[model samples]
Each structure stands twice: as structure tokens, then as C-alpha cells.
Target: MCFKCCLFLASLAFVYFAKAFGGAYMKSSITQIERRFDIPSSLIGVIDGSFEMGNLLVIAFVSYFGAKLHRPRLIGIGCVIMAAGSFLIALPHLLQGPYKYETSVSHNKDVNSTESILPCLSNHSMTEADDTPDLETKTACEKAAGSSMWIYVFLGNMLRGIGETPVMPLGVSYLDDFSREENTPFYLACIHTVGILGPMFGFMLGSYLAKIYVDIGSVDLDSITINYKDSRWVGAWWLGFIVTGTLILLSSIPFWFLPKTLPKQGQEQSESKSKSTELATVAEQENFLPEENQEQEEKEKPVTFQELAKDFIPSLKRLFRNSIFSLMILTYLVAVNGFIGMITFKPKYLEQIYGQSASKAIFLIGILNLPAVALGIITGGFVLKRFKLGVIGAARVSISASVGSFCLLAIQVFIRCENAEVAGLTVSYQGAPQVSYNPQTLLSQCNMGCSCSMKHWDPVCAYNGMTYTSPCLAGCQTSTGTGKEMVFHNCTCIGEMMTPGMNTSAVLGQCPRKSDCDRIFKIYMALSVVGSFISACGGTPGYIVLLRSIQQDLKSLALGMQTLIVRTLGGIPPPIYFGALIDRTCLKWGTKQCGGRGACRLYDADAFRMTFMGLITGLYFLANMLWGGLYIKIVKRQKKLALRNQAKENGQEGNGAVNGHANISIAKNKEDEERTGEESTI
Candidate 1:
């Protein structure tokens, strides 16, 4: 169990630095966006989405292929590729400096300083004026002028994704299979939990590194001035992306020790020997066993890769052709992530319109929205556990969340945009606490009627250039206009972050109207937390459920290839389609079109308000519900068919029945006694 725990941590460590896991891809993609690529936002989202789209299939393949080659060799090669891709992502910097020598610094930490010392060895000359400040800053160049070169970003994701995908399934499966010998789900869960933590920590760590670059590393390379005060408390905010990517790449190295292949030799030998003895006894009892059957029983046969691959393809086909299996896949896909479009794009929308920082938007994304999502899963699980929901339960959960979140997301979009009243905007003489009960309390000088509610202090918001020390006003007044601006005597912005220059003050804006915002915010936060937890809970279990459903009624079907196909198509298509939708919106909107996203657009204050809004929301949910019905019907039919076949197979084992039943029953009595009364025994 302990050994398995170590292996899982190793797998997670690799993913953490490699940036191929969880939100690391999103953060990295955001970096590319910041760097200003020519690619459309949706296209970028699609590419980023592609990292997880075919992950399961990649896992299955790596396990199969890694077994044929050396597992360690495959892992090592993948890591090297991942490292190379990471380097390419930082290429714009390398190109402005030295490419060859920079490549040599793959294993070195002093990479930035090394290049400065070797100035004569620069591979490319700088084109920007000395006053340009940052020669590597993509903003200096046209956004798309070098956006085509952003393929480096895409490749970075691809290489990292491909290399890390297999670790989850194979690694967990490895622990599950091996640990069963000692009776431990503890190891499996522990290892997987670590995998989950990797992403969170990776982000925190990367955010830290990003600050170091701006504050420490960039000092010698660029002409930026760094005052001691700035260095003492600055968190530039880029720390999360850079540090996460760097650490994920470095940490992925330890998966080298995990077992590559299953204990196939032992299982094969046991099966062969056990079957041989049984067949010989049967023959002797019959007094006339076939000589050929006896010979076949004693001789083990080797299956070639060509034969194995051939069988795997048909198995996959049979699984997919089964109506029930197909339904399961469809329903599950839509249920949990059908509204992925809303989830992914919503953040971008908030950032553009409200001028909200990414952190603030992430915080504002309303908790309850996600919680409603969790309740759906728990409801589905309840029906399954208590009412035998089976595949039906899974379908119900998926369809419900998919359809429901779709609607709720539309409402969320509306509240933030169309219905937003600017709700008494007043500047604070001093920055207010993130959570406040009184709106007017933020700006104490405001003579407007108000209510003060929160009991807290410390500022996370700063406007313009000056800092005001006076107490703020608190209010609950109704605004007369659609928008209102309150001026401050002088408000200064303070920057603090996970890294330097991070603008930590944003975290201080708890609830704009603590009473109202908190009411909405709490509900929203609950729902969102619920949603993420619920969705996460369903994912692996749901993956297993759908996989099993495909096999049912498809008796002895080859599933290896189907696993690859289903995982690839299911994961890839949605992101592609979602990205496409966003891009189309971008083309029609954007004045600036940051990376073709229609960024900071006029209509984004209300994206779905245009003609097809309701219909699009309704239609997405409606389709999800339809798939749900189809899934339930299929799962039922498959189970019924599988059982019928099972009965038929049992009937073939006749004649030795009476004596066999008596001896079997007697052996079971002893077997039960020997194994029982021990809680820890496997």
C-alpha cells in the first residue's frame, strides 16, 4: 500500500511540472492569450481543450504500447518531449536571445543569467528600440503578426497532453490490481487524491515562479527598474502560469519506477495449470476424453500483437454497435459537461465587461451554481444505490446537470450583464474589506442613505494612483439610473499576489453589496462548489459505468480499440464545437479581437441576449434530455440480454450436477470459515 502511494505521487509530480494536468493547461493557454497569438479564442480553447479530449484513449494506448516497448523508456522519452515543448512555449524569448545555448540549459536553473553572460553567442538580434522595455513582450509586435507562430503553444500542450494522459488510468489501475493482493483501496485513493492536489499546488507554485521571473530573473535581461519596496511586496501575477509549467515539467520524472506491465505471466500460468488439471479429471471420469482436447489443454498458446490488435478492433465495434452502450456514452457526455461552453467562456465574459481581474472573476463565479450541480449527482447516486439506478442513474445525472446547468448558466449570464444595475457604485476614501454588509460604508463621505453590515477591515481594491486613509461609506440605496459612478477623495491600488505585482487587492472586494451580493454570492458559490464536486465525483465512476455498459450485451466483444475511439471522439468533439462557437462570436464582435476572441467587445456585456439566446439554451438542454431517455432504454435492454446469455451458458454444464453441487457446497462451507471473522483479510 505504501509503495503504491509513492508511485501515485510520482505520477502526480510528473503532471504538476509538465502542466498537462487539470487547470494547468487553462493557465498556460491564458499565458499564450496574454502573449497575443493570431489564433481565435475558440480555436485556442479548442486546442487547450484537446489536451483532455482524448486522454482516456491515450492512457489505454500507452499501457498497451508501453508494455511492448520498455515502459521506462516510453516515460523517459515522453518527459524529454514534454520538456522540449515547455521550452518551445518560452520560444519567443529564446528567439530574441540564443536558441542553441538556451536549449542546452534544459536541466539548468541559471538559464536566464547564462544567456546574458554569453551575449556574443546570441542567435538572433533584437529589433525593438532600447526604449521598448521588453523586447520579448509579444504586445510590442502585432498580436497576430506572430500569432501563426503560436503553434508552438499548441505543440507544447499536445506533447505534454500525450505524454501525461496515460499516467492516470494505468497508474491507478496498476495500484488497484497490485494492491488487491494486500487488500487496499487506501493506496489507490491516496495516490489519486495526490493527483488532484498536484494541479492546485502546481498553480500556487507556478504563480510564485512567475513573480520571481519579473522581480529577480528579468532584472539582468531587461531594462526594468525594481525598487526595494516593489521587490519587498510585489506579486506580478504571472507567477502561477510560469511556476506551474516549470514544476509540472520537472516533477514528471519519477514515474520511471512504476510497474510497466501487469502480472500477466502469473495469471496465465495459473489459468493454464488450473484448467489442465480440471480437464484431465473430466476426461478420466468420462473414460473417453478427446486426445486433441487433452493436448490443447496442456500446451499454452502465445498471442501476437497483430492478432491482439485485430481482436481489439472488433471488440470495440461490437461494444459501440450495442444500442445501450452507445446511449450510455451519449447521455453521460451531455449530462456532466454539456454546458462546458458556458463554464469555460463565462470567465472570459466577466473579465471583459466588469473590468474584473481574473482572480476576482474566478471568485465571483458564484458558488451555488456549482452546488446545484453536486446535488444532481448525489440525487442520481441516491436513486442508483437505493433504487438500482445502474446505467439509468448515470444517464439521469448527466442529462439533469447538462440540461439544468445550461439553463442556470443562461440566468447567471443575464444577471451579470442585462440585469446589472451598477448597483450604487461609490468609491472608498479607503479600500474596504472584500466582504462588506454596507455599500456606502466603502465611501464614508457619501451623504446617500445607506446600511452598514459587515464587521471587517483590510483593503484589496485600489483605484487610480493615490491611497485614501479615511473610513468608507455604507449604503442600501436604490439607484435612479442604469449606471452610477462615485468618485473618491483619493484611492490607491495596492498590489499583492501569489507572486510579485499580482494585484492582490482584487481579492479584497468580497461582495460589492455584501448583503445582496452575499445572498447571491453564497448561493452561487454553493452551487458551483456542488457542481464541481458533483461533476468530479461522477467523472471516473461515470467513465467506468459507460465503459461497462458498452461491453454488456456485446458478449466477448473486443473493447481495447473501442476504449481508444470513444475516449478520443467523446472528449475531443465538444471542445472543438465549443471553441468554434466562441470563435464565430469573436469574428462578429471584437474591436481589438485579442487573439480573435472578440475580447473587450461591446455585446459581451450580454453575449446571449442576441436573437437566438433562449432557443440556444433551450435546445442544448432539450438535446441533452433526449439523449438521457435513449441511454436509460439501452442500459435496460443490455442487462436483460446479458442475463439471458448467462443462463444459457450455465445450462451447458450439466450431468455432474447432483454430486458436483454436494461437493461444491461442502467446499464453500470450509472456504467461508477459513476466510471469515477477519476484518482486514483480503
Candidate 2:
């Protein structure tokens, strides 16, 4: 490649990296945002889908028009817009007051014991004068009610979608146009490999940040009641956005200096000379036109707006006429739907099913999963180039990878942990499944005299393996230590549930599951890593098929159309619907301080695993069927074309031999006739 081409490729790669970083960070922070906003999974899905909504609005027009305009500059402008969106996403954090998490502990130091304090309890001993709220207190309470700030996050994500519209279509088309035909795959692979790194870093950043409290610098660590493992814990999610936005802004700068077009590397000079020579040779051989006239015709032809407008529909029609390209789009559409949903919720799945903290799940995905994907992409590209695989070869590779990955995913359905044992939700205080959803069931006979509220969900795990909704429900009269370290003593519920010789005590935090669940999680992670690598191997080849199947002129439009279809159908809906289904598996739901249902605290693991993996597996299986049909067609078409070309060459050679033999026979006859006439005259 020329220096300029190299620079443009680097710029494209950087842009890809920056965008992926921001996008992945957004995905990783979904759990944190859910807790921070006290929103359900379904609502979070809508917010996640908003980015695709923005892309859907402008992707087609941008890709079509951007092909004709200055592409690099358009991409640069897109990056700026993305940066703005990122900043906007973080705006709520600065504008809103400090985050307040729900807890059972009182803020006052004098309240040593929480035994007397019940959820929504009011002291009737107070006089009417004490019951009245002051005007200042009322005003402060009203001002603090800013939980609706999640709207900013949704708008910001949508804006990000708009900004990302140009990057893929424009960048890929630009690289393909300027680079050598064989080199295009490797270049794209490189870009994607670098892009994959962004997610790794982004998720890692999210993991690190999730361990830190949302109000770390502003709040006292000693006063905090919840750890990162707590369900209600909100992390420093906004900080990653700010950092990502800045990087995206920087990535846009290089594109401004790049030219709109660059000469094709290694062939620019030779191609011009060869074109002129070929034209002259053809003219002389056919006796058709003068060399000067041909030269004049070859000179620059200015394209007008009218001509471009007229050609647009015809170009689009020509593009879809190819059956292979259309099938590729359909197959890709299904695959993407599965992939997007899986990646978006994988961390949450890990957290809920395996009893992992959000931080740990995000960290493992970033550290292990993304790197494997990156390697797979690069390796796929290498295999293509090393083997010099044509269309058929690429298709076969893609199919193999898909089949292998699908099998792995299917196996995942069988490997699962048991559902969490939460009191009053999944199981009763007596360690039996509670099929009914009744608040009254939480008020057991053991703690009925304690006056505990059924609404409170501050669970304390007793020594007997059964958990209580709260220390008060456990009928604990006293507590030791404070914050997360606090332990409840003289627990009546524990005594009722425990065996004859066991101690009657309970501690803060929910009970941990069996140790075997951890072993299952490790096994799941190993299979996940291998499956990710195998599945990602098909990515580059699949993309190449899309690129090569379309006409060169329609390359941008074809890619844009594919993106539009996939984003609209796959990208926009999966997160929403997947989230809704996963929400069905939530065994226990958290309660907001302002009085409404919040994010899910726990899920039925077996149900969650079955739902998530089953959906992905079904989508992949359907996609594989489409791919098989496409492959068969491709192979049949290639065979027919090969036979036709061979027959044409053979016919031309036979005709040339027959004509030569006839000329030789005619000359021999004429020589004999001349010799006979001369002899007779003598």
C-alpha cells in the first residue's frame, strides 16, 4: 500500500477501536446502570436498543451518499458526534445529587440495633406537632426525587448510534477500493482484530470501575453498608463513558488530515500504462477506431446529480438480483441477532447463574472471551490468505465454524447451577420451594410476634442453611459489628429451622450456594472460551463473501443495506426481547426507596441458562440451515461456470487446426496443377 493508503487504514482501525471501546463499555455497564436508575431489565434493553435506533435513521442515506462524497471526513464527523453522545451519557452523574442506595441500617449512630425498626414503620407515640413536616424538609425531599434521570442515558445512547452509522460502510468500502484484491481480507481482519481489543479494554475498565463505588470520592468508605457483591451496588459507570468519549474525539482527528481518495498501491502507474496499451492494441486488431479518439473517450467524465439520482434505483435493483448476496444477508441477519443478544446479556447471565459478582463476570469476559475472538478473526483471515481460498472455500470454512460453535452452545444447556435459595421468593423459610407469591407467607409463626414487615428484603442467612427476609424476621434481638460485617444473634427463625444441636444465629448477606456451583462455573467458562474462538473464526470469511458477491460499484450500498437490515431486525429487538424473557426468570426483585419495583436481585439459574442458551442455539441452527442451502448453490454455480469456460477454449483450438489444414491442402493442389501445365508446354 502507498503511504497515504497505510495512513487511511490506520485511521480506520483506530476509529473502529474507539467505537468498539465505547460500545463494549456501554454493554458492560448495563447492570450498573440498572442498579443506579433502579430500572428493570426490559427498560434497560430499550435504552440499549436506542443506539441501533439512531443507526437505523441514517445508515442507508449515509452509506449511499457517503460513497460519492468525502468518506474519511464524514467518518471524522461521526466520531465527533459519538464523543458528544458519550459525554451526554455521563451528564446525569454530574447534574444529579449523590446516589443513595437502600439499606436496613439507620444513618444515625445512636440507633445501635435495627431490631425495633421495621420497613414503613411510624412511631405512634409522637405528637401531632412532631408528625408535621417542616417546609424546608419537604422542599429538600422533593428536590432529591431525581430518579428519572435515566432518560439522559437513553438519549445519549441513541446519539451514539447516529454517530456510528458511517464507520463500517465507509471505512470497509474505502479500504477495499484502494488496497489489492487479495489484501483486502487481511486489512479488514486487522481492523476487526484491533476493534476486538477495544471491547477487551472496555470491559476490563468496567470491571475495575464496578469495584469502586459510584460516589467513591464523595462518600465515606467506612459509612457504606454494601460491598460490590451486593445486588443494589452501583459502580462508577459514568467515568468510563467520559474516558471513551475523549479517546473517540482523538481518533477522529487523524481522518481530517487524510485525503478523500488515494492511488491503488503497487499498480497505480502500471495500471495506467497497461490500460492505454491495451486500448491501442484492441483498436488496431479490430480496425474500429483511431487511437486519438479512444484516448479522448477515456478522459475524465464529470458525474452530474441528475445522472446519480437516476442510477441509484437501477444500482439497487442490480445488487439484490444476485441470489448469493441476498442469502448472505439473511444468514448474517439471523447470526447477528443471536450474537448481539448473547454478548449483551452474557455478563448478567454469569452473575445470576453462577453467583458471580458483576465485576468478576465483566473482567473474565474481557480478559478471556474477547482475546479469543480477536485471535479467531486474525486466524480466519490468515487461513484465507494462506490457502488462497476462493468463494467456495470461504463458504465452507464459515459453515464449519458455525456448526462447531452451535454444538458447543447446545452442550451449555445441560451444564447449569441450581436456583438461588432466597427466602419468600424461590424457597420458604423452611427450605422448601414456595410456589405461591404471597407477602403473608414471609411472616412465619416463629417471627409473627416480632412485628417485622413483609415488604423488607434485607435477608440474613442463618447457620441452619435457611435464610430470613431480615434480622427482625429472624427475631434477632441484638447485633454485633456494623455495615457489611454485622452479624445477628438470638435468631428465633434460625432456631426453628435448625437441627436440635445447631446454634441459633444469623449473619448479614444472603447464603452462599454449594461449592460445586463454582466448579461448574469454571467448566462453563472454559467451554465458553473455546466456543467464542470457534464461532468468531467465521466472521471474516462471512464478511468477505458479502463483499465479493456484490458488484464493485454497489459495494457500499450492499454493505449499508446489510447493516440496515441487521440493525433494524437483529440489533434493535434482541436486547429488548431477550431482557424480557430473562426477567421472567428473576426469582427475587429489589425494591426502590421511592416505592416501586427495581432491578432483579436473584434469578432461577437453571431457568435462566435454559432460556438464554436455548434462544441463541435456535437462532444459530436456523442460520446454519440457510448457510447450507447457500453453499450448495455456490458450489453448483462454480462447477457450471468452470465447465462452460473449458468447452469454449477447446472449441477455439479445434477450429484453428481445421482452418490451417485446409490452407495447406489448397496450396499443394495449386503447386501440382502449375507443374503439370509447365511440363505439357515443354
Candidate 3:
């Protein structure tokens, strides 16, 4: 039953992820513009990045305030917004074709503008045979409708970004709220596992949406019945989205099923704010109070946001200054960046250079990634408990940075697969060099992009009874060595591309195959392994441990606010800064520019140098820093704060006790004086 609940949520997540999948499609369309519509690559990034346009502001505000508002509702909102974004992505395709009608507005006001300013597509390197968006050149059609259609699609996705931003944390919190009684490790594992499958299943299932068919006369996988678009695949994915969203929303109801009992994340804030307001009102009413009484009354005033922002003054005074927080944040930032970077290289580098289809390789990577993460998490859990560690110390920000960076180092080798494969294949053919994807024939079962159509076609590959004919060409390669003799190996994919022929798995052989089919199995594996491991070690564990640590610290709202400040810093884009450097140096490195794929792909020497070097440098900070460099400062600082706080409490109690003792002594002296006076009078 717990598994069912988890799977249900996973389905929902899968649906939500369709937006991401759709986003990938949108990128494909824009890339097509570069190839077909004659748009530039620069413009494509702009258009794609626009989907996440101003996401930082939204994500930050939403995450912070959403906690301050309501948890479940915010999650629901996130789902709605993400779905809308996914739907908007398909709008351009739906609107494609000649429109005879004109807009109702005078002066030609339309629903969308800037469509003609197309996001860039393919570069000039591709053979002219590649199909690109065909812009109607006839002047007569200018008045009918313009690129505004595509622009609408772009703008729609941009608007949807706001809604998509909150779904993750909010949903997790919602799950946390509901799963209060479940075992922590078991519950968390369920959530994490489902969360991944949600999006994946969404894409897989959504591909077959409502049996809807697209009628494009150009091509079909394997060239079988290629005249019409197939609806079954897309229908499945659409159904996935609706089903997942509906179920997630429904699952959330259980959290709200019983009457509200626990204090909401916001109640404490409201209470604190109210106290502050009362104190301010009283202070404003009078300029001064009697000296003896003033200190006593002032001590009762509630802490305010304004005063606390300055090094958390009152908290510091009370010895609530937590240095672990700082250490954790630093460690988390570096580790995540390096680790995410490492896995990303698989698809970006392997597929880009070697032209291997990403599906097969990425899948294998998952098998590897999952175990590593599970192991890491279990290991971390043990380490944390044994060390008497708090959440910040045990989980994220405190995470051993080396795991990620070292993993990245491992990632560097796989990227060479593309180069190795191309060199191996070409060299093997011409007697120059050799290569392999490690698990040879791994491509045999991979159907990712290698002609989804069961039928075999496309001259790029030919089919035997089971697999395709000829060696694999691998669309999104791991490597491409064009030196002395242009050696190539590793059939990144020896399978299929959705061509206008039949049995796409067949026919398309050995030639630069699996076109535009870079799956990045290695990246997926690394991410699955590393990302899961990190989350277990830091991400989920961090959330889980937060409550425990807060309890241990005996901090109320004051600590919470500091935490709020800490969390808000995450959305601040080092990515933009990273992007800035990429813009500066990526072009110099050659193909596979510093875009999404750039991180994963290791094509050129410069790209290799930049990415791997960055990986190494960042890793050094994450692991070593976590283990010793950063952690020492953290441990010391936490100890200091803890000691200081303990001392202050002791001092306050001691002062009160001393004052009581003095009052008692005075009473005894007065009684003695009265007794002596009575004796003298007698």
C-alpha cells in the first residue's frame, strides 16, 4: 500500500515532468529553426532559457512565502502551472499550417508577436537534406498570420515557469506532512523513487496521448506507413500527465483529510508577528519607563525580522549563532554544482562527440547510479549517527564534496567513449584505432531514438531478423576523433532514427546513425547514482534532520528565520555566472557550446579542459572541505555557539538564584532585629 501511494505520486511527478520533456521538444523545434528556418544558435538559448525566465525571483519568493502561507495548496498550484506549460509547448505544432482567417483587431493586433524572431536552430554544418521549418516566402501570406504563433508558444511557457517552480519542495513538504507516521527511511525512499519515475513515465506514457495522430507527410520511424502522424504514443504521455496530476492532487487530500491539528509552518510566524506588533504599540505609547521596571518589560518584547537580519543579533547574544549552517550551505553549493555537472557531461559529451543515441547508454548508467546512491545514503546515515552529527553536519552543505567531483572525474572517462567509439569504429574499419561503450552490444536492445517504429527502414541502418544491419553510427556520439585518419568506435547507437522508412531499427546501419539521438545513459546513471546519493545524504536527509536538530538546539522561530534566509540564497544563480563564463570561453572550445549539452559533452580540448578542470577544482572544495577544510570551521563554530548559549543560560539562572538567596538573607536579618527590639522593650 505504501508502494502504491509512492507509485501514485510518482505517476503525478511523471506527468509534471512532461513539461520538462515538452521543453526538450521545444528546444528541438528551436534547433530545427537554426537548421530549417535559418535562425542563430544564440537566439535559441534565449528562447529556451526564457522558459525559466525570471525563475529565480519566483522560486525564491514562492519557496519562502509558500511555507509562510499553505503547503498543500502551493503544491497543487505548482502542478497546475507545470501542466499549463506542457500544453503551451504543443501549441505551435497544433497551430502549424496555412491560416486563411485574419485577426479581428484593427491595426493587425494578434494573440502573439515576435514569432518571426525565431529561436535559432541547426548550424550551417548539417547537410541541406535536413528538414527544417519552411517559412512561406510569398508576400501575400504576410497579412494572414506571422511567426507570432511560435512566439505565443514561447511566451506561454515563460508564464508557466512561475507555477512550475514551487511544485518540488512544496510537494515534498506535503508528503512529509501526510507521512508523519511512516518510517523515515522507508517513506523517503518511496518518495524519491516515485519522484523520478513520475516525469519519466509521463514522457513515456504521454507519447501515446489519446490515440492522437499528427499528419505530417514527411517521415515516420522505419518508413512504415510514413504518410500520417501517429497519435497513440503521444496519447499515452498526455494520459500520463492527466492521470498523474489527478492522482497527486487526490493523494494530497489525505493530508488534509482529517481536521487540521498540527501547527502550520506559518502559525509560528503569525504568533511572533502579533507579539511584535503589541510590543511596538506599547513602546510607541510612551517615551520612557521607570529604570527599574524598563529592563524587565523590554525583555518581554518579541524578536523582529529587522533586528535579526543583522547577524541575528539577539540570537547571537543568546548563543544561538549556528556556524554549522554556514558550513552546510557552502558544502552543499559546491557539491551539487560539481556533481550535477559531472552527470550532465554524459549526454552532452558522449552523445555530442560520438553521435551515440543517449537512451541505451543512459539506461546502463542508471543501473550503476542507483546502487551508488543507495549505498551512499545508507553509509551517510550510519556515519551521521555515529558522529553525533546534526542535519547540516551529516547531510547537505556538509556533504563530502569529493564524492561528486571524483564522480565527475569518472564522468570524464565516459565522455571519451564518443571519441573512443568513433576512433575505434573508424580506426577498426581502416586499421587506425579501437573503441567500445564498455558493455559491447549494449546498443542491441536500445530503442530510445533508434526508430521507435518496430519496422526497420532508413538506409542509415538495415535490419537482420533481430537487430539492424551494419555497425552503429550513434547519433549523439560520445567521441569523434578526426585526426590523422578519423578513428571512431563505440556504436553509441547501431539502431534507428525516425526516418520516413520502415523498420527504423533496420536499414540505418554503421553510418553516422541515431541522428539527434543522444540519450546520455552515463549521465543518467551518474545522476541517478549521485543525485540520489546526494539527496539521501543531504537533500532528503537534510529535511528530515532539520526538525530533529531544531529540537536539539531548542530554537523556536528565531532559528527558523535564519534557516529561511539560508534557503533563499539557493535560487541565486551561480548558473548565470557559470553561463557568463561559458559565453566567454565556450565558443573558443568548438562544437557543443556551453549550453545544457555543453556540461555533459567533452568534444573539444578547450571544452574538455574547461569542464574537467572546473569539475576538479569544484570537487576539491566539496569533498575535502566537507571532510576537513570546511567542516573544521563548522564544528568549531557550532561548538562555540553551543558553549556561548549554554553559558548565557547558566548565567541567567545563576543571577536569578543569587538574587533569591540575597532576598531570603535580608528577611532573616529583619526578623532578628524585630526579636531583639522586643527583648529590649520588655
Q: Which scores greater on lDDT, model 2 or model 3?
A: 2
Candidate 1 lDDT over 1-682, as tens digits, reads 2443555545644453354333543542352243233244557666665555435436555655443344443555556555555555555443332111001002233333322222112212322132133434547443434435556656655665665554444444344433342222233333444445544443444333333433345444232222111101123323343544556556656666654443321222233457778666656744664664454444235446785576555544445555544555455444324444445555454443343334444434433333333344344444444444444454555555555545554554343322121212222333322322233433343322222211112112233222212112211112111101211221122221123444322111222222354355445445545545544444433533443343222222223233344445544555556555544432122212112222212122334333223434654565566665765664555454444344446663233754455344444333322322111111
lDDT of each: 0.40, 0.80, 0.37
Report the C-alpha displacement of residue 288, candidate 2, in angstroms: 17
lDDT for model 1 comes to 0.40
lDDT of 2 by residue, 562-598 (tens): 9898998989899999999998887667766555577
Best by TM-score: 2
Can you give the TM-score per candidate against the true fold? Answer: 0.55, 0.87, 0.50
For model 3, the superposed segments whose C-alpha errors exceed 4 Å read 1-55, 60-65, 97-160, 164-190, 199-327, 339-345, 353-355, 365-398, 401-415, 418-536, 541-630, 641-682
TM-score of 2: 0.87
What C-alpha RMSD separates each model from the true structure?
14.9, 10.7, 16.2
Steric clash count of candidate 1: 71
Question: Whose TM-score is higher: candidate 2's or candidate 3's?
Answer: 2
- Of 1 and 3, the candidate ahead on TM-score is 1
